[model samples]
Target chain A: MRIEANTRRGQPVTIYVDGTPVQAYTGETVAPALLASGRRAWRVTPWGEPRGLFCGIGICFDCTATVNGVPYVRTCQTPVAEGMVIETERPLERDQ
Target chain B: MNPEPVHTDIAVVGAGPAGLSAAVAAAVAGASVTVIDAYSQPGGQYFRQPNPAVDPDPQEPRPRAGRELRHKAEAAGVRFLNRTVVWGAFEDLRLAAYREDTAQAIELQADAIILAPGTYERVAAFPGWTLPGVITTGAAQTLLKEQRLLPGQRIILAGTGPLQLVTAAALVKAGAQVVAVLEGASPGEAILRQPGQTLAAVWGQSTRLKEGWQSWRTLKKAGVPYHRGWGIIAAEGKDSLQAVRIARLDRQWRPIPGTERRLEADTLCLNYGFTPATELAQLFGVQLHWRPAQGGFVPRRDEQMQTNVPGLFIVGDGAGVGGAELAMVEGQIAGLAAARQVLGDSTLTRRIEALQPALRREQRFQQFYARLFTPGPGLDELAAGDTPICRCEGVSKATIVQTIHAGADTMHAVKAVTRCGMGNCQGRVCGPLVAAILAQETGQSPERVGQFRARTPIFPVPLTAFTVLTTEGAESAESRN
Candidate 1:
């Protein structure tokens, strides 16, 4: 099978969630991989609550986090790259 | 911060046959086009399972047919976003979509929008259907189509729909011993629905039928027992499906008391019919009409496939459940029509008109199959008292019956009482079954069943997709509890 390696080919990377830096393989979708890496909660629900990945697919949009300087990247589908800074605790208003 | 919505001349939702054709046609007509779809690859369900060995890669030149058309579209610079889905549409043709890699919403303002979102396999409820081995014919087909894997060695393909026949045939081709196909339609009834359908099945597939007959003549030659008027009363097994109990039905299609028979099988595939992925269309607020010919409610469109919303066209199964050929032809017509609508080209309009006959023939043929393959009345007979009506919520037939008897006349009432349709899948799979039961219980028509309540997040979006602390969460009580 000619595996179409994800957009980011074998590039080692370190992604920091909050202030903790952890090594991760390249081309891994952020959310599940981060959870696999040991982080559990991505954000707090608007009503001063905690919410994790509710819908792994893009439909729920619950796994959003800041990638580098850009906010609102769906961690589940976005592939990781080298030196990518991921911020999970910035309070932002819901789109709805 | 709200990002500025990107503006494009034409935004085609879905990259299946219809959307692709529309995008190509619009682009060929000199309009900037953006084609978005959910799949990581092109080709919707029909062409979805193209074997890597069979399909051409991006580097390779186009396949034998339609090479030039695709090349022209590519040269015309149509932007193909393979893994994007249109969440919904707002007034003034604003399309809300999300990329596959990032669920982050993207907005697009389009002068014209064509929805070719296609259809999904519809599953009705039955006992033990949520068991591991119970899966939709479409799901099994996906396994075969995408991964080239057979579902099982011995399988029973059940339910009423054209998909059952084709899937049984495909599974057999993929080296499976299909024990039998439990068609809900009585033989005479199924054959009778064919003639009024324009003789499409016979004329269109005569060559293939001839081949299939010769190969399986002995199987049919001997009384291998294909119960003409029968339906599955219950699916039973532990951990996985080991067998299904079927019963013969009377003229009114009720299961006879003593005719119940059990068949040994590993996998049970079922499909009542399919419904168009109308989320986007409904979001656009396009007028829709219930067409029994097309399966169920579909967007209202003219012969050219244009919806009431000007510059917005629909094609393929999304328009109605015509097969791939029809989808392609409709795509061509819609593509051409959208092109003309954008360019106001009389020549293109004439060309589109010329293609209408073929498209109509295809639709008529589908109408035949739709009627022939429509779910038989036997479904009411098979939802036995013990059968679990809602697989996701594990609500049983007896519970629903109790709810119905206690004055819960509608599906919504049943849901309000039993919480059957409140699961993540909404009512996509079990809705039709519950509707059938409710209609049967109340002596109401099936149309009334259409009022089943549906919840948001229709698709089974993985919960893992949204979480950041994936490891810690999944590693905790989730595994055991």
Candidate 2:
């Protein structure tokens, strides 16, 4: 759900989330792009509860996802780059 | 493993209004200033600008003003360490900072430190609040302003402060169908009852009055229902938000029975106001006093705005709940004061004195909000037994209540017992709500319940961030560990 700001002069960039390519702009961050791609819940808690974007600010780690092989990075605070790989933290299937 | 740390006359944490002004004032007065901010840009929350690597947002005035302030700071020779976090403040004003992008770690040794970490939205817990698509009022604004994205199609805003109105209007303008705005207080009626104080508060606050009026008019023009004395009692959804249950409130913000109504919405933004991010201050052992309306417990400061910790100053909403204007005034005063402390320049007193009138006006405006929009006492008791109290740890209200009833009534004791504040958020998400609930659950004063104790690396940092940057410690780090 992105309204065309049409204010973007920054070149287009694509970042991959869970192996799916998400189109974004240079100024965009990982979380918004993921939201734009219609993915509401970024993480599935150990209790199998869904959580995403609680505090848009970086303080809350509800938005934590793996970025470029780094685990538990706050997606809201992390900017997007071409070929950037992100994976949302999830409960193990066995646990589920 | 030994290396020379960066030395500066003053290290101002957070580059928002307070930090920017302080950096500029101190630097202009010939103090070597270094500003470390988490955002890539200079604006803190107040003057939040989009990422500067892209085209500037022409639609907003904040970006332009922020650019000018940042330019002034730069011209005054303030060095910026943007996109960096000051995770820990060590002995002797040593700040442990890390840049996530570059994985650069810097131990900044400053003669004086100005803390303007700013405020974050305070979450009042309710049922289904932990569900996805339920976000804070600030989150909605950040999504629109920063990323130019709608958080949801059908949005419902609920909260006490004027930020709810502003966010609602902004959402409407952004083409989102903002269903309704729920204000817990009837401020308009409240104003009529106390005209003189309201008039005094709004007299010199023409800009704010104009802004709030414009937002109100925007909502009215869009035919959005503005419900006064009403607030959201619960968000309804399975995995994500599908709707919200809102209700009219009594004077103490307790929901009136049979007044409950549900609205279908994909997004529910709730804000009770903001709480100062006092982790760093608390980590420094600065004494904090409670002013429930002024963002909970704020650091005790002197006439010069310096805390009991010498050379340490806390200003802006981070210090308390004052708005941007007050932050700038306090920033300017503290900046000059810190500059004077370090540079041994006594001539900055006049400049500091000149900020008084602006400070007074902004403080008066803050008082007005405290009188008008402070959430009713009933808000602190909204979370039911199964309601998630700590969003991060997924700790239920029952767990917290049981822990309290088991003689662990204090915040620290509750945290230690139930692991409420032990998640990645480090209590930022659950601190205020838990503390207030602890106070209520025990019928004790806030002082007796106590705030969370902050530890080193107050913000969660990656072990790799340490290893990737400070390799000296990275190698000896694992070995030493």
Best by lDDT: 2
- Candidate 1 lDDT over residue span B308-344, tens digit each: 7777788889788887678888887887777777767
DockQ comparisons of all candidates to the true complex:
0.04, 0.77
Error of 1 at B351 (Å): 1.4
**Candidate 1 backbone clash number:** 12
Which digits, one per residue and each the tens of the lDDT, describe model 2 over residues B1-481?
Answer: 2256789999999999998999999999999999999987778777888765665644578777888899999999999998898887666777778886777777788999999999878878888889899998888888888788899989998888889998899889888999999899988887899899988887788888889999999999999999999988888888899999988899999999999999999999989888888888877778899887788889999867899889999998999888888898999999999999999998888888888888888889888888888887889788889998887788998898889999996788899999999988888889888988888878999877778888766777765444323323322111221
Give model 1's TM-score for chain A to 2 decimal places.
0.75
Candidate 1 regions with alpha-carbon error over 4 angstroms: A1-96, B50-75, B186-228, B250-253, B398-418, B452-481
Candidate 2 residue lDDT tens string, A1-96: 877756453578989888988898888888888898898988888888988887887888899888898888888988889999998888893245
User: lDDT of each model, Cα atoms only?
Assistant: 0.64, 0.85
Output DockQ, candidate 1.
0.04
i-RMS for every candidate (Å) is 10.8, 1.5
TM-score of each: 0.72, 0.95
* Candidate 1 lDDT tens digits, A16-51: 877788766553456645654544456653433333
Model 2 stretches astray by more than 4 angstroms: A93-96, B57-59, B464-481
Judge the docking of candidate 1 as incorrect, acceptable, medium or high: incorrect
TM-score of chain A of 2: 0.89
